[model samples]
Each structure stands twice: as C-alpha cells, then as structure tokens.
Target: MPTPGFPPGTLDSEGDPIWLTELASDDPNHTLHVVQGLEPAEALEALGAKPRLFRPCVLPEVKPDEWTSLPRAALALDSGDSAALLAGRIGAWTFVYDDAGHTLPHDDTILLSADGRTAASSLYTINADASLSYAVNGEQLAHLNVDDLDLDEELPGLPAELRAAFEAAGVFEIEDEDLEPGEADYAICMRVVCALAGLTGTLDDLRRIPLTVTPFG
Candidate 1:
C-alpha cells in the first residue's frame, strides 16, 4: 500500500477532485492564489507584477459555460510575451486568478513572498487532479498531495482560532482511508488554508467581484 498520511503519486495525480472543480469557471487549467491583508494592486506588486491598464475590447456574449474563459482570451497577449491575472479582494484576503496557470505561489520565491503574511495557492490540472501549497512569514508550512482522504497532519503554522474553526467544521481527517466516490479531500485542505489566512467567499462570489487586471512577468 502507499503511505497513509500522504498520497500515492505527485500532488497532481488523478485522485480526489480539488476546489478547482467548483472554483473554476468552466475549465480546470487555472490557478487561484491568496494573499492575506493586501489590496489587489498591493498583492500584485508584492508578487513583482507591474500592472498596467489593460482595457480589453467589448467582449462577445458568451455562453454560461464560457463566461470566465472567454473574458481571459481578451487579456492574452498576441505575442505571448506576458501573463495576465485578475485580482480582487474578498474579506481579508486578495484572491488572484490566472487563467494562463502562471502565478506566484508556484514560483521559486513563493515562501519569500510571504515575508510578513500568508500566501496560498490551489491548483487543478487538465488531468482532473489537484494540489495545494502554503506559506506564512517566509516559512513554508505545508505542501501536500491532498489526494482522497490521505492528507498530512495539522498544518504547522495554522492559527489557533483557525484550528478551532477547522475542528468544528470537521476539516481535519482523524483517520487514514480511501475516499468515497464523491469525497473531495483536496477541497477540504484548500478550505483549511484559506480559512487560516482569513479568506472568505465562494468562487462565484469572487467571479462577481470587480477585479483589477495585472500583468505578470
């Protein structure tokens, strides 16, 4: 058998579904990153993105399934020289979305970027698999392959209040076992990290929020 507190393959392995399954607009090939206590512009600046005014042309009326994806194509560069992101504030966290799938929490300096606060990323691939990573005060607390019910122990830098909330929410896995048909441990793990950083709002809430566009190098 594979390890119990961990999963069988890479974090991107095909296993339990992630928050991206529901968090995404209609596609899974995207990234959502959260930064604590920052405004949208501030968060992008900290991530080393120099955001310029990117006024896209009038978007075509898209089908419901194409709602989010279609808007992103307008943000893409014809030369492919840069990446784009949509950022907005929700509660105490700034949520950044990159339909291009390039974002900070996956970068080499991810931990350093969390020098004073927390940063977390939840990713899902086209293979229909997911993974999570998080850092606090420049220290990486956890990076897990949250496949099925196979998750690591309680996160290292989790706040006491958040821990309490997770406990009450039944977010902690008390045992190690395979997941049921529809159980989503990946989403559960993302929820804990987001809660720890004071992030609130569903994907729909985020999609509806007025967001600023930032250009990523």
Candidate 2:
C-alpha cells in the first residue's frame, strides 16, 4: 500500500514511509524545509529569497523551454552568500529545496518569523550527517541528529507523543556500520517530519512540480 504517487517499493513492506527499510535516491545531499501555513511565495520570501529573476523577454505564445523556464531545482546560486531555491505548496505545507545549503531556511529570521508560521528543516549532507529540526511559533525545538538520536529529557514544547513515536519507530536504533550510513535514516527523518507537518504528496512531487524559483545571490 505505498502512497499512490510515491515510487513503488519505496516504503517498507508494511507500507509505512516513516519506517522505510530501503531508500535509494540519486539526489541524496540536499536541504529541504517544509513550513506549515505558508504559501510558496511567502515561504520563500520569509526564507530570504530575493526578488524573482524574471525572464528578460516576454514570449506571449511560445512555451518557455528549460532555458527560459523557472528551474525546478537550484541552479547557479548553490554557493557564496545565497542559494538557489524553489518553493511550492502541497496541502498545508510549503516545501523549500536548497541545492547546497544544508542550513537553509533554518535561519531564525524565517523559522521564528513575526508572521508566526512554523517549519521542519531536514538536511542530508554529503558527509552523511543527517538532522531534523522543528521551529514552532518563533521557538526552536529540539534539533535531532539522526546519527545520535538521544533525548535524555523531554524537549520543551515538543509533543510527548512525537518523541514516543520516534522511539517506537526505531530511529534510535540507527547504527554507523556501513560505508555510507544515514541514507535510510535521512529518508526516515524527512518522512516523519513531513508527516508531522501534515505535508501531502510524495518527495518526487515536490521535485517535479512547477515551483517559484528564487535567485538569492
């Protein structure tokens, strides 16, 4: 019973994305943040997106090719002071992707925005350091390092049930035995965080859909 748009065999045999037994992804190193109660434009702006780099020419009838089209993923702004990002909404969640910025949108200015929206930022670095952090109503919640899933005490304002859920999901059982660990754990972290944020649609949906591309350099 894999979620309909999700690739077949992605979920565990039990059909749970949170406890995925195997996950093979080509694009493993990226930053994705899903914010609650924000539209794509608002989320990007709050996350420090600069003004849209509108295409210079207006072709009224011709379909814009990839060269002229808004990029589905980060392009030139992967380094320096800014990052290339695309933000889009799926249900109540707005998902933002940063090509190389592992800490994108986790900035307090965005997560702790005066507008009061919250977000869950998930990062999977090339070094296999995976983490998931939540921002709620201007407060930074526990930032869980997937490799070290240890919570000695209850995190303030974090739902007790969510903590229990992580425990029950065996997220604490992750080990560093293989050549590249945390890949599966990264998927688990993303699914769990997105689920908690009430984000609908598959990860592929976010990657493929038409989103607002913002150049932040």
My TM-score estimates for the predictions, one after another, are 0.62, 0.61
| Backbone clash numbers for all candidates listed | 0, 0
Whole-model lDDT for model 1 versus the true structure? 0.52
Q: What lDDT score belongs to each candidate, Candidate 1 first? A: 0.52, 0.50
lDDT of 2 by residue, 120-196 (tens): 77676668677777766776666777666534443344566345434333322234434132133444555555555
Q: In model 2, what are the clashing residue pairs, if there are any?
A: none
Number of the top-ranking candidate, with lDDT as the measure: 1
Candidate 1 root-mean-square deviation in Å: 7.9
